[model samples]
Target: MRKRERENPCGVCGHYHKYEEGEVCETCGHRMLATSEKASVHFSAFPSEILPQFLYLGSYDNASRSELLKTQGISRVLNTVPACQNLYKNSFTYHCLQDDKSLSFDDANQFLENCERDKARVLVHCMSGKSRSPAIVIAYLMKSKGWRLERSHQWVKERRPSIDLAEGTLVH
Candidate 1:
């Protein structure tokens, strides 16, 4: 088992604790949700591997799960959403995009390219894994693998069928 986090965030009250799964959170006095409970779809429960071991895609919920990230050997996080908190900064390296309105793929893909070059396991995530984050991953594929947009989009969708790229994000 991974050692308990010395400053884990309590889901209910936002207080930090020395935390482990199934243990009681100090501030909220509520029992932590066990691992089985994290499988809910609403939780962005599992990460979709985009490049075998090197690249992964998930949601803010998955990004928040230190245990899950650790299990996957993910060492870096590319947070596509400005609003989602980088919850495990002490455990992972994070690159957060600043713009919420229209993110350019160039900057985002640069981060993805760097992680790939270093062979670091990285997760790219937004509020939900469905849209923003997947778009980012697709962009990375297009750039890194020299794939066209449609082909790249299809590739990620096949791996993570939950993806739903917003109409605004698609090119004609």
Candidate 2:
């Protein structure tokens, strides 16, 4: 620990900050709080199980929950965004998609399919469990279950009610 760290540590995430670091702690993406304030956690930190023990869908925060993932039997992860860091490479098998576009749907589905074949549980996630991650899960259903777009979507929606797809991401 550095001398500055010994002096002032972030109140919320407990990460030590240098004098130049200012208000927010870059380590945990949390802003420093005043003495009276308390830190809060995002509810979306836990992934929603989409398939009986085989698949889950959630946000980047969900992907970071290593111990929780292990408890849920998730041995692999399929990250839908390129920018989101893979928090536990050693703990879980991961395939980070380079981008999130319609063209990338096939690749995401292929990864999901492989995990299913191997009987491995995987968590598919983007920045939020809302749009990108759900889209990937929907695509996987279409290919694996012979379901049409609407049916596949409804299936995923039934499981995770929080999924809010952007208008442009939805097919007519």
RMSD (CA, Å), each prediction: 7.9, 5.5
Candidate 1 root-mean-square deviation in Å: 7.9
What tens-digit string does per-residue lDDT give for candidate 1 at 1-172?
2234434465533556534456654433334455675464344467899889999998766877889899999999998877667777899999989888977688889998889889999999876688888988998998889999989998999988888887776675
* Clash-forming residue pairs, model 2: none
Off by over 4 Å in 2: 1-42, 100-103
Model 1 has a clash total of 0
Ten-residue stretch with the least lDDT total in model 2: 33-42
Taking all chains together, the TM-score of candidate 1 against the true structure is 0.74
The stretch of ten residues in a row with the least summed lDDT in candidate 1 is 1-10
Native-to-model Cα distance after best TM-score fit, residue 154 in candidate 1, in Å:
0.6
Candidate 2 residue-wise lDDT, 1-172, digit = tens: 6776888765433457652444554554334334443233235557888889898998776787789889889999998777567878889999988853543988888898899999999999876577888988988888888999889888888988878888876676
Candidate 2 versus the native: TM-score?
0.74
TM-score of each: 0.74, 0.74
